[model samples]
Target: MVDILMATYNGEKYISEQLESIIGQDFKDWKLFIRDDGSKDNTIHIIDNYMKKFPDKIELIDNYNRNLGVKLNFGELMKRSKNQYCMFSDQDDVWLPNKISITLNKMKELEKVYDNKKPMLVHTDLKVVNQDLKLLNKSFFKYANIDPKRNTLNKLLVKNTVTGCTMMINSKLRKVISEIPKECVMHDHWIALVASICGGIGFIDIPTILYRQHGNNQVGANSNSLLKKLIKHAKDFRYRFYTEQAEILYRSYSNFLNSKDSRIVKEFIQLRRYNCIKKRYVIMKNNYFTNVMLNRIQMFLCC
Candidate 1:
């Protein structure tokens, strides 16, 4: 059975439509597990109403109601998952009917090739939509210039292409993320890094969900122009956090990482100590560059 882990906070506006989409899925063998992070709005009340209607298929994990933020909230839900396959859900996005079936099928194929004990992740593209559910972009990956195929350990450390809402993980991958680090850029990025290092990651080119973008979105698609994106990246780049995240990865999974992987993580962490030119050189030498040219240039200049 698949366990759908959804973390909600102030999602009253679109939560019902999201729930309806999940309930109408063609794949029936799944249970929805929701945890609210102390929302001030009527989000919890709406969830309670849904719980009354589909008590068998949906559950509200009410034991913890404190606010742990999004990353920790999802981390707690991951810890409570007790199924073979697990998928992350956003309270605002509408999943396509075949999302579970397609993702699970790809996950099963990955399991057949790699042992069941090996960690694996399967993610798909998404359709970018406005708050009103109008299609803003046909493909999220194209909209963001993300190449989901570039999912190696070194590559993912620089840029994460996997979106949590569109991804499914095996129990092994779930175990790999036993504790979410405070240094993690995001839960999905951390999970992708673990899967890339520990086992494998697969991707489906098809859009699986309507990724809604709105004012309240914690993180949404960036449809800015090239110049605007470059200026924004230059202004907001936090080089220290990336180094800290690498250090955490090296410290946490040193035993599982091979010598090459260990060296890559070490080099990435050490980039902060080098001169700007040397930093750019090391990034280029190690091929730690994203697919987007502007972002890669920014990384070279900022790091």
Candidate 2:
């Protein structure tokens, strides 16, 4: 059996659709646990109405008025789930009927392959959507090369490739993730980081969920237009520079390494020095930049 953990905060507009998607799933052995983080709208009303309709399948927990950010809310959900396998759900995303079954099967396969080792988390590709549930594009995870090894602290430092809405973490992972340092990044990123540390991380390349992108989206969805891309870059730069949030994530990972093994901590310290701001300048100083610029100019002039 699986427990679906969903956190909500004033998501009345799309909650019903997302709930319907889950309720319509072909998999029968699952329960949906929704924790409302003090929504000032009819979101809680909608959830309560659904729970009354399907008392056995759906349950709602009133989280009062605590504005626990996304990471904390998700952490709370994980801490409360009472199942062997837990899947994270966003308030507005619509999952495919096979989403749970496919992810659960993959986790089962990985368990068999890894043998005595603990199971790692499994996440699938997502189909990006708009507020009205119109499909924009699929999140093709081809841009970054995913390392298959268990220890991927080095690889994860480059980017967070896993999307939370499509994530299904094992119970073992859920038990230990709460111990992650408070300075860590988003929950999904932290999950990926820990999964890389504990056991093998698996990915389902096909899209199994509709990752809705709305106006109130905390983290902007991936964009393709040049202007939107630049705007997103600017926003990220502002966040990273002003809050130094990425550094918090780095240090938490560093702490995790220190607790795991001293050698990894030392290596992480060295990498922080080499791969920090100075590393970008050092790479640009090499002849690679000159050759790239010359090639770009030649191509542009010919065009």
Candidate 3:
């Protein structure tokens, strides 16, 4: 059985569609753990309505507590789950009918091939969608062809190459995530980083979910324009460096004990992160350095 962990706050407009999508999954042996992170709107009301209709399929937990961010929300859910398998859920995204079945099959395949002691985390590519659920010609499955054994810090440095909403991680990985440094970025990235270190990640090229992008996006919209990315990089430094992303990656490099090729790539990333923290003037002075700094800042904040 699968437990779908979702955190919602003022997501009334889209929560129902997402909930319906999960409810309609071809894989029926799953439950939805709905937790509202202090929603000011009818997000709770809408969920309450749905829970009334399908009490067996959904469980609502909305005891208003402190406004814990996404990382803590996820960590809290992991602590509460007793299932052997758990999947990350976003408040506004709709999963395809076979999402659970496909990911579960992949995890079982990995389990057969690798040591049982190896912590398992499997993720699939996702199709991007708008608030209205219109499909966009993009995916989070770019790393589908990557060799799990060859996964390295350097590959992770060039790009995150991981999508959180589409991930399914085993409960055994819970301890590793619980112990991750709080400064590490989003839960998805943190999980990906930990997976890279402990066992390895299994990737699926199939698009399993409609990853919705909305106005109050915690990770913002997924746009493909290079010019737009360049512009946003300069504007969102706080979203980048101060977040868990920078620290998690830094820790990954610091803890990496693998191939020299990957280690060297991570070293550059770590050095660059270190330089930025020290407020390296060399990066600020050079035009190209400024661009790199801006890009780093953007990634740190968004991840």
Candidate 4:
């Protein structure tokens, strides 16, 4: 009933554990579409062995062994995805047995309300864990302060609370994200923005995966203290890239945005194109800043 798009890259150390986790899922109506991102290690071997064991449920994408970074690989996965719903998985994280069932349950419930026509996204919180799988935090949302109320089009311009590994996106969102412009940012961020603009986001407060935090993690969580996060968000250099990337998303999908969202994005884009006082005025007059005050000030400093 669901297609799991898993991207692997040199994950020999924990591939078996991760695959076992997936195989142990309480929800069995799922297929694993593995895409190896040029793993120099035995990652592919491990996945192949698993595919051999579960040929009916798991298989590798053909001629896709080239290294395309996680974002584009996932975008390609979306394009090739075949199912009513799709789920993303990391090569190393150990998912809870209930991960697929819980996410799919929420996805189905949300689609029912949206009549399955709108782009709906369902994501759960995660239990941050260490390399050895020791539990760190129970809820990633609480540790990261990921509030669903702030997941609007404007707020998504600054922050992304929707972690891909814990998300199950419907076919509508899968198709929408597959066609997102190349200039857009990461797949998860682009998906969140698309969900906000096209349909809606459904968040599960429960942790669905053991989000590992190994030293070699490509993109790990920021489990810093709240004060540290605020100070970090208040830095001009920090927001420059995010602001620029947000501009790319706006520039690419402006027409897809609603009138209000479109105007805000248009104004922000036009505002940033200017120099001196006009830029500052635009920043002040606009409501596109992040939900936090310090972050807004930091973005202002960026301007």
Note the Cα lDDT for every prediction shown: 0.87, 0.67, 0.68, 0.78
- Top model number, lDDT: 1
**Candidate 3 segments exceeding 4 Å error:** 62-64, 138-151, 179-181, 216-303
| Candidate 1 C-alpha lDDT tens digits along 200-295 | 999999999999998856243364576777777666556677778888988998998999988889998998899998888888878886675865
C-alpha lDDT (0 to 100) for residue 210 of candidate 3: 85
**Prediction 4 global C-alpha lDDT:** 0.78
For lDDT, candidate 1 versus 3, the one ahead is 1
Q: Alpha carbon lDDT of residue 61, candidate 1?
A: 90
Clashing pairs in 3: 184-244, 185-244, 185-245, 239-301, 240-300, 240-301
lDDT of 3 by residue, 1-115 (tens): 8988887878888888889899899989988887777778889889989999999878886555647777777766776667888898988888899999999999999988875
Off by over 4 Å in 2: 140-151, 179-181, 218-303
Pairs in steric clash, model 2: none
Q: Kindly indicate the candidate among 1 and 4 with the higher TM-score.
A: 1
Compute the lDDT of residue 17 as modeled in candidate 3.
88
User: Candidate 1 or 4, higher lDDT?
Assistant: 1
Ranking by TM-score: 1, 4, 2, 3
User: Which prediction has the highest TM-score against the true structure?
Assistant: 1
Backbone clashes under 3 angstroms, per model: 0, 0, 6, 0
